[model samples]
Target chain A: MDSQVTRREVLKKGLIGAAGLTVLPSVIAACSTSSATTAPTAAAATQAPAATPTPNANILTGKLTLGNNHSDASDLKGVNAINDAFKALTTLAVTTNTVDHNTFQDQINNYLGATPDDVFFWFSGYRMRFFADKGLATAIDDTWAKVSSNFTAGFANAVVGNDKKVYGIPVDYYPWCVFYRKTLFADKKYTIPATWDDLITLCKKMQTDGLTPIAFSDKDGWPAMGTFDILNLRMNGYDFHVGLMTGAQKWTDPKVTAVFQKWATLIPFYTHGYAGLTWQQACDTLVRKTAGLFFLGLFMTGEVATVDATASADIDFFPFPFMGNSFDAEQALDAPIDIAMISAKSPNLAADLVNAKAYMEFWAKGSTQLLMYQANNGFIPTASDADTTKFDVLTQKAVQIVSKAQKITQFLDRDTRPDFAGANAMQSFLLNFLNAPTQDLAKLQASIQAFWDALPVYAGN
Target chain B: MSVTVMAGQRTAHNVARRRLSRGALYVFLTVLALIFLWPLLYAAYTSLRPYGEVVANPNGFFSTPATLNLNNYFFVWNGGNYPQFYLNTALITIPAVILTLWISSMVAFTISRFNWGFNMLVLMIFTAGNLLPPQVIIVPLYRLYNLIPVPAPLSDNGLMYDQIIGLILIHTTFQTGFCSFVLSNYMKTLSKELVEAAMIDGAGVFTIYARVIMPLVRPALAALGTLLFVWIYNDFFWSVMLFKSGDKRPITAALNNLQGTFFTDPTVVAAGSLMAAIPTIVLYLILQRYFISGLTLGSAKG
Candidate 1:
């Protein structure tokens, strides 16, 4: 009986002990992850390299590692193809480390602070500038000097850091446009809308024809920002849009209110229960001809092709219709460019700096960009000398559309500070407006400004 | 005779009532269990279907079996870097769990057996360590790991950062706190006379702990060992934060590889997740008897 009692006590103690240990830490993990912020590290403060990257008589033979976020099947293939091509040209062996796209973005702060790869794939605009300002990325002026003539002013500006030095090489970019099935349009006998009123009329026509006038989803939070970007760009022009993104212009301004009001006009045309759906599911609607239009990036083609390979051919898009304002002829659009840059903290940087710079220079060349473009045509080359003759019909039309634009913006998240643009900030605000578009605009605008004001200034900035 | 007959009829009626209630209770429990299992079943169903078809009709589960295939499983297995991920997780988790148990048991034995002045204080200190959130220490820990140099066999880069040994060390360090607290409490319930008797027989503290206390605590250790294995295996925060090399990450982090920039095949992701869950499920099943007995042993003290 004594033994039995002691054994029972032992088991009870063990249960309580083990349970406390296993369960509580996971709860702590959940709470702590949200508060994880990057502190500015003491990375090097050197400016642009002074010397031209003329290879010395000594052969460069060390390996250069790359941190890549292009994990999509074809995107990975495209990246690999470029690496293989770059390998054939130099004695430097290149190793690519591929991480999931979203995780890579979330972990970028820690990754760059740690032992980062010698070179890495990243976005242009503020996202690039954010890290560069932290002294995380190496400025590549020498590499840019060799490749400057191959790119345009837009591409050049996208890669420039706040310090006015080039931090990365522009590889490819995809424009955001209104995509619809060409066959569905022809069947409905719909003419392309060139003006705001014409667009409303077309939506009404599409609705009467038993189609969802617009397919929209913000379950992922960032998708709704596209609609906001286009509406703001159309109503207020590129300068105001940039000012608002940079917080130089207040959200409560009349021009910003006007953009929101205009967007409210098209709210009735959107698919119902959109807040629960993903962009992929919404893209399925456009592919199935259940929806008349989807305002998204050019990557919509990839989503479409995954569902039905033949259906991608029927996909066509037009820029958002003119808003009948002064910014109409500005022809501005979001053409977010992907970039490749060098890490200042890479342990192998000293051994492989020459090859790394050579690789960046290689990425800038039109021929090297063509290798990736050939593997994945969804992304148009940023280089001016990229062969247009090899472009497919869609690629040719995309290039033509981008070429005509007088001003270009990166996407909303790309253009703003990451902390302010994260899911908790603009993402949730946009989601709130979408969930209840009729909510008090004044209060919502105040909330946005307050959130922006509350953010700590970037230490390095 | 009538009185006896009336009693017999009442007994039969009561028996019938009890059987009906039992049937209803079983029905309720069965329904609850199916609800719990629905997600896993649905994931299995999705994994067997073509990714395209599943994406096109996310809710349509009434497809023919002919449309179901193992292509997604094959893709996740053959195409993904899962072999390396599994190997890395094993290298990290196995040693971490073993060391946590070994160190914790020794700590537990000392505090529970001895009548030292700081015995409770030592236990409290270990318990308090568990209360510190890992995020608060990540930056400092990262800097510390970078500063510490390991021998060539343990770390490829000389520093502890981005190495398997570093992950193991962190997991062991973080887990030992909770484990020691629980274990010391468990050991305290043991008969002190047993340790006193052994000591009188010329047994040292280590001998008493190994020969007597260890045998008594085997059930508790088994339970903890199982729980620790699962917790450490599923850890994403530490490995993803500390490791720079993608190839060195564990299987939990490998699930992100199936997600693409533009599009993700939910079916393929479901397949990969299900495969990742396999080892944990198997471990639980094998140790299920010990787990159950460990949790219930002291509850019926009355």
Candidate 2:
């Protein structure tokens, strides 16, 4: 009787109640309103077991709102095409918002309400863990399986939740590779280097030839993070990248130390004014033909377009030439972008989510892909055979490299273990610190390693 | 002939002096205007060009006139979820200004006129409230807001927890401390002759303040209102703390999203920034004449 009374007390206290009452009203209101507006379709509700099985009949409906990351109005086709298609498929509204990834959570908190919009585009890895733990996500596993095989996945087996549920989907995926000005390389009369020695020699030749070997920006500490991540991929290979992110390997390990060493040696090869330069500014070094190399992804193609659209073909991107190609170049490191998801506490939970799914699926394919490529001068996320006519020679090269890669590495932001991801910002900090000859490289190394030690260890299934 | 030539030389000399003073004034004003308009000028120039151009030519001020690319504005509006942001900002700023003014003026009138025994203590408490960091209140407030349930049958679409109204309430409450302090100080200058006359006429405290003293504080009110308007717009810490949707975002929150994304389109960003700036610039233009007068009035009265 005492236990029973305790349970009742807890319920009354709303500690663990019938539902989160703050969000309950919106849920109830949306349900009643949805019921009144549209008859529930006879589609089978996905009753897949939490393990592995196909889900049926869970058609996410209503307006699926996604946060637009890094895209402006001109990049509409990528985000809104799916929104349009979702509208065509259902009598529901879907929308998207463009937002900054840096302050995304802080920005979202300002709008927290019971009836939070049905869907939002946020991050994965540690950020996603924070949301998932807080119960912000709708755990769209059942919805995922229904459309799982429809579009191919980079890492189909590894993307599932602990209970074997899939949490997010892929939008655009790529390996953060060395994007070089092809014309500069050709003009310099240099062949593509086969090994690390060849790369160093090329950098020296470029330096001697009065050209910058690489372009980097440490202003936000991100361009350096790219430098660090790429070096880590080279030093430790893809497994170590996964291990370090999951807290399986200490960040201060000799292997990790080697990664930092690589960045330190390469710093001299970077642009002269990199300390205060933004990535966009640094990218201009390549676009305007001042610098020839940048270690970034196809995403940067968007920012450098005004330099000269044709010189984009002067660019050639290649994944870090692995000393050990355990896998084919196509099977090497590729980063997959996190997909759109429905919120558990959304206003019009059922209808809104179904509508949102349709839009996201459309975003993962078609003209959106082409617009993304043409606008950025990067590779589109499509099969190799998807019309090579529109692509310039530069983007076509990127397309050929991406198509044959069997396994794409997930983004460091997403693939890193959840706890460590929160502290991953420190990696960029240490790398920037390493660039200065005055700073103690040892201290920088320890500071980042300390944060790595502090992260919680969670075992992934 | 000599007298005529001398007269003509003297007239020409006078004209040159007058023209020189006018030229000096124009030069000075032009310099001052450039100083004042530099930020907007930079933002405008930056917005017109594509990111590549700016990167290649960071110091280029006027070599080209790039069209004020509407790409960023429309992108922000449609793709960035700026519509919800505008709505949320309105919700937070409007109520915060109105209610704080009303509450502060009332508190000020009572404190200034009523000879309450602990009035000084009350004033001191309110004055000291500004010393604490707002972050101290955040955790408690979050829990408190979470615990306080919304009434039943609440609209699903309406924001109860993190909407603009909630932000308005927090800001309104926080601002009252300073508003009351300023109002009370301003009210002290209310001529003793008027108060004495009112008291002799058997006018109640409320009636005296409402009829006599309130009208006198119009300039003070205007000064306070403008300050409040700028504060709400420039705010970053709380707006992010309170509101989550991109649609409900303010200019500050939205501006932050510009450079960090994978997309490095600087042209779109510059355009969006210019768009965000337009209203504030227009507001100042509308209110500048009265604004300075209000400030001068408060300082002189004090």
Instruction: Identify the leading candidate in terms of TM-score.
Output: 1
For residue B189, model 2's alpha carbon misses the true position, in angstroms, by 2.5
| CAPRI-style quality class for the chain A–B interface of candidate 1 | acceptable
- Per lDDT, the best of the predicted structures is 1
Q: Please give the C-alpha DockQ score of model 1.
A: 0.28
DockQ of each model vs. true complex: 0.28, 0.16
Q: What's the residue-level lDDT of B260 in candidate 2?
A: 45
Compose the digit string of candidate 1's lDDT tens values, residues B1-302: 99999999999999999999999999999999999999999899888988677556635445545488899999898777565667667778989999999999999888877778998888889989999999999889988887897866566566789888899999999999888877777887778788889989999877888999999988789888888898999999898888877777889988888998878888899899998997777666556666676565434422
- The lDDT for every candidate, in the order shown, is 0.84, 0.62
List candidate 1 stretches off by more than 4 Å: A1-59, A458-461, B58-66, B188-203, B296-302
Clashing pairs in 1: none
Question: How would you encode candidate 2's per-residue C-alpha lDDT over B1-302 as one tens digit per residue?
Answer: 99989999989998999899999999999999999999777777666665544555645434565444655567666655554445445556767899889998998888887786999999889879867789999767765654454442431233345455567777788888888888888898887789889889999877888899889888778878877876776678776665445445666776775654555565666776776665455455455544576455435443
lDDT tens string, model 1, A1-461? 99878766766666666565456445644544343212111121132332234566323455667898887777888888888777676644577778889888888988888778889999999999999999899999999999999998889999999999999999999999999999998988998999999999999999999999999998999999999998999999999999999888999898877877888889999998999989988998888889999999998888888788889889999998998889988899999999999999886676667778888988898888888888788778999999889888888888888889989999999999988888899999998888887888999999999998899987533
Listed per model in order, the count of residue pairs whose N, CA or C atoms clash below 3 Å is: 0, 38
Error of 1 at A68 (Å): 1.1
Fnat, model 1, is: 0.46
